[model samples]
Target: MTATAGAPAPSSTGQGGGPADDAGKESADTGPISAISPADSPVSPVSPASPTAARPLPPALPQTPTPSPEGSRPSRNAPVRLRALDGLRLLAALMVAAYHYGGRGGEISQAWGSSPREQFPTASTYFAYGCLGVQIFFVISGFVICMSGWGRPLRSFFASRVSRLYPAYWAAILIVTAVFALPWVAFKSVSPSDTLVNLTMLQQPIGVDRVLGVCWTLWAELRFYALFALFVVLPGANRQRVILFCAVWTLGAALADAANQPFLELVLMPQYAPYFIGGMGLYLIHRYGHDALAWGIVGLSFLIGQHYAVAELWHAPNPSFFSYRSTLGIVAIVAFGYLAVALIALGKFHWANWRWLTLAGALTYPFYLVHEHLGWVVVEVLHQKLNIPSYGTFALTILLMLFLAWLLYRFVEQRLTPVIKRSLTAVRVR
Candidate 1:
């Protein structure tokens, strides 16, 4: 495996588990790494692992994406290469970790309210804003999925998506459940019904919550996959059609929000669709050159995305979590926009090719999967009993979480994804 491709076993976030040797300023493979084909091998269009072979760009992304002249846009039998978005992935994951760490201070404070409480005041105050990372993740997901899905069959896409999501997710859920299920530190009890529900990663739609709270986002991610899969079937689709389809989606969301239609909002993914849409806009620019349609999508996404922040202002118990000094109405806008700009830089700048950043990004999905509740439990237990300052506990917690994420990446997601892919890819979608 190249040191920075393949990730997440299939959920939350995944760090790259493929080779890092080829993460150049101009990425040449359609993938960071693939199980069916190695990066250096002669391009094989028939390989099940060719994630960017000739098919159709999803209709959801209507306008034909601009491609770099030499290496973008594979022909019917051509090879496709994609720049690793590992750096972006890692940045987004860390943001969520920071958000959890910053916000969960209240949990510790509640547990030991009477004691000496001299802890990270600034860390507590500002890091809470890291919650914007989840939105960043959604945008990254949209971009990555589009990159991965180009010129591929729907079944192949499903196999690729499923293989990447499930293994690491299952491992994480089992580990965390075991941790929380212990009697001495029992924060939650897991039952068979919950276990079964979580295994499908559809617990939210079924009215059952996930064993790990973060698994909730998987529902939205899966929904996006379903919608975008339609576009993959329409290889002949044009930009105007894709733009119209997305515009209609946004309108549906706006109408849902205006009428407070909870079911529509929940099913349509209204809260974060614009970010996902915005990410697709970046994908077009990143793969192809700038076009009016792609830029228009980004612009309209920014405008329509406002509905989320505006709605949260009225509904969220903590509105500051959604704001950042008002330079942008929502912190997600700044995060998504920053990342979009960064995508362009990756195309144009050599310095963006740092190897370690890609490593961090590859491990992101696994880290995000494992960090949340377990980290909170550790901080609460360590600081409350041992009298460690919250800062010390927070630092230690981050270290521990990062270490665990590395383990998941190195041992589980990175190692196992290929085996699963080889087997799944061999099935031939009969």
Candidate 2:
């Protein structure tokens, strides 16, 4: 364990999906998601997981201190804004977008086979390896959860998550639905039930078809939030309780993996939880210095779960485990990736802390939400009928995606999120 330096200074964690996991509610020190002038906007690097000697809480926020692991309200660490996390958010989104662009629009069933170099003679060369972005996102998801809940009340935490999550999500749904409705792009005809269910981001267990494939990750994200919120509200929560919870989670994932039960795997969110756990481990090490428990869980997660994660995440084509792929390679790749997230949390990624990038990071949630299906449809027409080169198609699709993502962030999301936060703040005041 290294020294716990530079935890969230006191203001941010954000809307759950991207760097902005709690982007709504008290996402701003003065106002929710206050206007993002480069000179004033926050990079929102990380939020503390427990109370300690924290920076000052925002003046506008009335300090209604709640009991925490450290003792009373006064001792609880106020949230700090970490600047580097926005860079990670954009990076993760780009990876996922690359994966989709290069890999026949990746799904749970996407298989790059044993040799990507040989098989990916075309655009696959570019997009095939990028699917690991989802893994990176899981790690971010775990960190954000702990950061967001650090010392907030249960009602406030839930409200923060809701305000952070729902506005952009609803906007994404409408954007995608409208894209299909316009009729210029070739697309699947989604049923009313499917569209409605997909909007909820809870379609899988219910057996409704997702409006887009990437929506599956959102479901797991919401579930993880639910699980963490429970941890937040349970009697006498603290770091040790969290550690025990993760240990039990790791054990359950191992059992589910050995059993090879697909439905069960998802229900437990086990296939993806280790990466999420790895993230939590990073936060712990950063918060309290390296402890045996945190490091052990992170290492064990990589050792026990890497192979299983690659198999399920990549969905190896031949079906005999890593089959054509190198098992060690998958393990190494995942281990390093998880470690990278933790390192970034420690403010080691200062190079990525440019203020302009926060705008890019803010766009990640919307970018991820709308890109896949629309890009697929557009790329299909551009390649098939218009006969655009792979490179050109990818470039144009990215531009379109960027434009749409920006519109959502600028017009729809930025506007709605603050309103939600203000309403919630009023509730707290009352």
Give one digit per residue, the lDDT tens place, for model 2 in 330-371.
566566667676676554564454556656656666677667
The TM-score that candidate 2 achieves is 0.75
- How does each model score on lDDT? 0.51, 0.54
| Worst 10 contiguous positions by lDDT, candidate 2 | 1-10
Model 2 residue runs over 4 Å out of place are: 1-80, 105-123, 233-237, 256-266, 313-329, 380-388, 424-430
Off by over 4 Å in 1: 1-84, 104-118, 233-244, 259-263, 313-349, 428-430
- For residue 90, model 2's alpha carbon misses the true position, in angstroms, by 1.6
Q: Write the per-residue lDDT of candidate 1 for residues 1-430, one digit (tens) a residue.
A: 0010111122211211111111111111111111111111111121112333332322222223333333434223233232234554555556556655553333334433432123544554455445455555565555555555555566556566665666667887788778766777635545767767678767767765456655655666676667777754345223444456567777887788678877877756777678667766655655445566777877777666555544442233453332222434354544554455345323433234444654555455666676766775787677777888766877788788888867876787667766675676675555
Instruction: Assess the local accuracy of residue 246 in candidate 2 as a C-alpha lDDT between 0 and 100.
Output: 84
